[model samples]
Target: MDLREKERKTVEILRALKKVNYPGYSRDIVSFGFLKKIEVYDDDRVFIDLEISTQKEEVIEQIKEKVQEEIGKIGWIKGLELSVREREIFRRQKIPIKGKTVAIYSTKGGVGKSSIATQLAYTFSVLGLKSSLLDLDVYGPSIPKMTGTQDSEPTSYDGQHIIPVEKEGVRIMSLGYMAKGDTPVIWRGPLVIKAFRTLIFSTHWPDTDVLVIDLPPGSGDIQLSLAQEVNIDGIVMVTTPQDIALEDVRRGISMYRKLEVPILGIVENMSWFTCDSCGKKHFIFGKGGGELLSKVYNMELLGQIPFDYELLELADRGKIYVLEKKNSEVAQAFLSIAKKIIDLLKISV
Candidate 1:
């Protein structure tokens, strides 16, 4: 490559590196990324070095992987120097919110609430914060259907505690997995509550950083019971760009407020649809619902995901868009929203 091209590539790599935002510490793990040196040996080969200090080699490896990814942007780059130094990472005894609970619900169904929750949990796992998704939508458990893994029962770690099923990195617990695929979960209110409690307290969720609960829609008894039982860090209300859905969102937000759970933010899904043929944007649901709701409720409008055919295709195949296409516009939007959620929770790895 010519000098001009090399300089441009270097700039692009640096810009990409700046976009990585991950927590630097865990309970007993002090992890951070530091630049050691960089040497350009030739027109296409570059040696990048990193200094990672942590008791866990896994932690250092994580930093190294991130560095390599940034450096690889300048194609033909070769060789990596990763130096790991073990040091004391202060240990603190605190409640395990490594497994922090977050519930995603809407006043109405089909607002893409489950998709947002699934993507959020997947993003957390990708960013090195272990997370899980609990499908508490007893009436309609779609997480298993979306993610495509099923019938995998939670194993008992001690023959007494159940371990959640893992997928792509995020642990998952669902009624869909427990019951036969075709069989509907026909249960009473008390039975639903019991199942949910077992899913939460009984499951041996690995030292996870977050647990995103996909709740059933509306001001239902199950939703209220979930809010009452768990110490939820917050609730993420989902809605489309229509007054029909936003009206219910207002009620959902109010329910969370009454239950004393904070409203993390709002996700406006299917806010707009773009035509592939004409390359024109269309407000299929009639715009302005998200903005109005945000204004009235006093919460940041986290994101507005346009309706994309590819996203649905990927979701149907158990593929997370963010992981499948990291640099795509949709993936970038999800990552941005994930960062916002982390900031809201004041969470650190």
Candidate 2:
């Protein structure tokens, strides 16, 4: 390899980082003790994790811009991922939910992420446990449609605390419930952040055994903000049994790990399809992506959920799949995963 194309070391990155000063501050972010990690891994890529003591958007962006520009100066840098986790400027009030919070996350969308989250919450309820589901997928809030709560609006007698809609013993809340019948949420970043804060702080979440949050797709402001604000017990990573989906899952895992968020396990969705007539399991989206990730990351292979062709129609029509076919292989996959989650997190159910 050419000398210029040689892999950069942590010390080398640190040397380059000395030039990056915090926004409106003379001292470098490293000297100010904001740099938490500088990892150079996988194909000469760099993962920089910064933990700052401010929530100001402009400051964060300024630091980000300056750092990226400085890091780009390294000619051989094949890839760069920078995560800036901002601390709450003020000691804010915690959300009303009690007990453990198990977040379901995916960096890429349409991996049946939301569906898995819904079924997990439902399964918790079926096991005679108080369960709540929070849909943090702001841009595409599918919880209301999945739970058959679109016609209902959240109500609050006290005006300060909003009541979550209940269905099949599971308490639920989503931005979709506020929209006017299938309307899209088209807000910009600042407003989207505010909306996330409002839902978490405003809702009068009842005491429950566990709360499952369907995090918005991506390792962005939403995920960072929630991690900084809420006490997430652990996260269940959802991904399809395909390379495309697995790539995004890796990035998401890195972000959560940097935030010190516990990874409960991984759920491989649409892993296979069982042909009714042939009675054979066919791998629709390639095989063993989930197991590969689990082995690589040392995370448990929670379960591989099969593709039930009927699930698309059932979920679209607001019918719970687990409840519809309790004896089904797919349904069993969901229930089995739920049990593992409770056991892993040690949540009372």
In model 1, the runs with Cα more than 4 Å from the true position are 1-97, 245-247
Screening candidate 1 with a backbone cut-off below 3 angstroms (N, C-alpha, C), the clashing residue pairs are: 25-349, 98-208, 98-209
For residue 67, give model 2's deviation from the true position in Å.
16
**Model 2 lDDT tens row, 312-342:** 8888888888888889998888888889988
Q: Which residue pairs collide in model 2, if any?
A: none
lDDT of 1 by residue, 110-168 (tens): 88888888888888877788888888888778888788776567787587677778888
Model 2 superposed RMSD (Cα)? 5.7
TM-score of 1: 0.69
Cα shift from native, residue 124, model 1 (Å): 1.6
> For this target, which candidate reaches the highest lDDT against the unseen true structure?
2
